[model samples]
Target: MSQVLIESLSATIVDLPTIRPHKLAMHTMQQQTLVIIRVRCSDGVEGIGEATTIGGLAYGNESPESIKTNLDAHFAPLLVGQDAANINAAMLRLDKVIKGNTFAKSGVESALLDAQGKRLGLPVSELLGGRVRDSLEVAWTLASGDTARDIAEAEQMLDIRRHRIFKLKIGANPVDHDLKHVIAIKKALGERASVRVDVNQYWDESQALRACQVLGDNGIDLIEQPISRINRAGQVRLNQRSPAPIMADESIESVEDAFSLAAEGAASIFALKIAKNGGPRAVLRTAQIAEAAGIALYGGTMLEGAIGTLASAHAFITLKQLTWATELFGPLLLTEEIVTEPLLYRDFALHVPRTPGLGLSLDEERLARFARH
Candidate 1:
């Protein structure tokens, strides 16, 4: 048997329309752009993956254009001649040279894992290890920015049995105004749904100090990234003092950040994101750290499309426990899908497919239509 070498690597930028304008603290998302990654192997197998972000450079360092550019110029050259089956070696090679392109690396790593899984006739979950669960309970984000509208959306989702956990995007408006909005939605939904808030690092420590107390008292389930990621001491203080548990999102840019945050007791829950940690395997490293340190885990998303969502799902299914569940409702937020079949969401959970690789195939015509020329 001969070693199967990677023949080529390519990335395409696809712009997909969203169901609505997704309002975050930093920016409003009119649409989502995905950097679709494809890795061609000598054995004639091609694997697909996605690297997506929210609001261009608004969310993180890697924008869609930058991700595509780096994948083409830097990642492709290093991976083209490597052993396609040796994902560990391939990832290590990227790590040795790359500094902080976790978003780009995640897509490449997913493609490699997808390729390996396809070659071996196994699902990516089985390739990671064995899955403990075949489905994950997904949380929906209500970011319509209107209290009544957001409540209506939640009711519809609940009516359809699609979602019962709603996370509100706050911190964009005045603290009191945002508080009123969140509390109003919570009041309307009242015990029927688990309401949470992601401040998106908008609140300062002082504002969060009071806001966290109010949210916790009002029956909010969780508070995420209330203050800035740069204020380590403040995060530690808030974590220790807040009535509700604080979840680290932006603070964890890598696995090392997870370890450091754990050691410092900066947060009680960690938001596990594959793009932030480098890849599916790398994100698991962060999950292990959280598990070892007794910190809870919530599977987070960068609002990725189908390929990225399923890739994240495959990694998440292998976990022993996900204390805060997941927010893998990215696909549902999009008005269009580039995949042949959309992912199944039923009874408030996203079902993980047992099929090979990520259990998805690109709809080529759709992809071509959405791809940026």
Candidate 2:
């Protein structure tokens, strides 16, 4: 075994246009900003990672700007001379100084894993306890907020055998309006697709109370984060009352949050996101907690590009069960790809890379084309 010393670490902000505006409860995203992390080792091997957020600050505390600043000003300095092969040690060094840059940490951790996997001649998934499955069923988000357009899009995906699980971004419209849209789409798709909704914590308890039952009655598979994440009492009430399974997304940020939700019986399902739970392995810890508490698993996305998406896929493939599938169609939403070989999506599932590392290599030309600088 050779000790690979970290020689350099850099973060770049890349702005890529989306195929269309992605509407959410808080903000509409017309483009995706990625905080791309590149780590080079003494052995001359380089690994790539990404920290991506939707609608920038509208979505979460970590923005592309903040991720880049934190990584360059603080985290990257800590990692410069460390042993890249000792990923835990490298991560711990950052944890001691940093508090809540989970997105940045995720990016760094991903790059570390990619480097280690390449060095070991294995895929990143193998390094993460080996993959239990090679391919993951991916879900597409219908965020156009147009009933007819969403229906048509879902039909097209189903017809093409691309995505059978559809997640509608609701709660932006009025309760009645959102319900009508959801129901209409569900009715149109019929049993051809599984329809779910992510409220993104837009509704109050009262609104969720009514909407949950209505959606449940209409055959919606799940309702995600109907109420705010802090409203644990509301979550508990909704979990007990709603016929549709309540999934906690904004609620479960860390392992501690997962335990709290599980202990309070706040939710029936948890949306496992790599950036939210710190990194790939950290999210796995959150998943383990959810699994022990009997909460169903959902592989959520931050609408990541290739680096972050594959980092997530690597971790998700190791999970024993993903009941609600995944929304890892992040890269597909972008107009351009930064990876040389884009992730393979077919038959309604995203296939894991068999190549060493994250099974990805950056397209420098595309990176230069989209680079914010």
Candidate 3:
């Protein structure tokens, strides 16, 4: 007998002050909240998961408030008595009743797997089918703003040996103006680093082609989401014209989107974020499809903290064909860490925790310190 039983679950909204404001092409500033979920099994084992959103949830269609509400009002009730080790059964019920709030669902999923890992005396990665690799390469982000500032930030990241690859944010609505800014940053970086640009669905096909020509001349690696996420026509046109390989972020929200993008050759590489594609299983399936088609897959981020980041790290290590670099460096930006087992970075790679389960422990005290109403 498992001798394990689920107990009451709790969620909190926490405000993590950024060590420094992180700007993107879309916007800037902070005040975002993370939806943190804690689950306990009567065997003295517990697990933690987080549901995070940027710009206070409006950007994603669900905020931490609604996340907590869904966890309390629906998900928790269905799991209070189920076996902690029966993860699949629990997921069946959770998915059957809750179709939306995929972010919230991801948080609860982490808690369930966490509980399972604790009960089985294993790490969450083991429950996910064991690890294929022990570490992942990391890519640093260049926040949108002045060309000088962006170039300076890139230089600093390189000097620290923290990031070997960089994703620079562009898109000020004018193609030539943004290209000029990118050119200046590239000029400063020289030939010592690799650079990629994320337009965040801000360019039209014609403008994207023009920008690609300018960036390609400077040895840029790839262009990400240059056109609207929903604009299939624009995607096709950009794919046909782009001199650099194209990658997709916002255009991919589900496995269906993944298949569609791959079929149309809209993306040469796919950015897989667990939160963006519904859950872990969805991400794996997408990666399998992508790799099958000879497209490289890169791990992505949703600006997640320790809990979500660990989940992503685990999935990334499991994916067999993760050739592209990952950007799971959200913790490095925060003023403090919420995990007990610190995630370490060395020589531009993130070390995967070898211990059983997700290989992370929540700092309950720190969680309280940053709780926001």
Question: Top model by TM-score, which number?
Answer: 1
Candidate 3 residue pairs in clash (backbone atoms < 3 Å): 122-356, 122-357, 123-356, 123-357, 124-357, 124-358
lDDT of 2 at 250: 89
> Which one wins by TM-score: 1 or 3?
1
User: In every candidate, how many clashes are there?
Assistant: 0, 0, 6
Q: What C-alpha RMSD separates each model from the true structure?
A: 0.5, 0.9, 1.8
lDDT of 1 by residue, 231-284 (tens): 999999999999999999999999999999999999999999999999999999
Which segments of candidate 1 are over 4 A away from where they belong?
none
* Residue range with the least summed lDDT across 10 consecutive positions in model 2: 53-62
Query: Model 3, 316-363: lDDT tens per residue?
Result: 888786767899887776777777867888889888786766778878
**Candidate 1 local accuracy as lDDT?**
0.95
Worst 10 residues of 1 by lDDT: 47-56
TM-score of each: 0.99, 0.99, 0.94
* TM-score computed on alpha carbons, candidate 3: 0.94
Query: Which pairs of residues collide in model 1?
Result: none
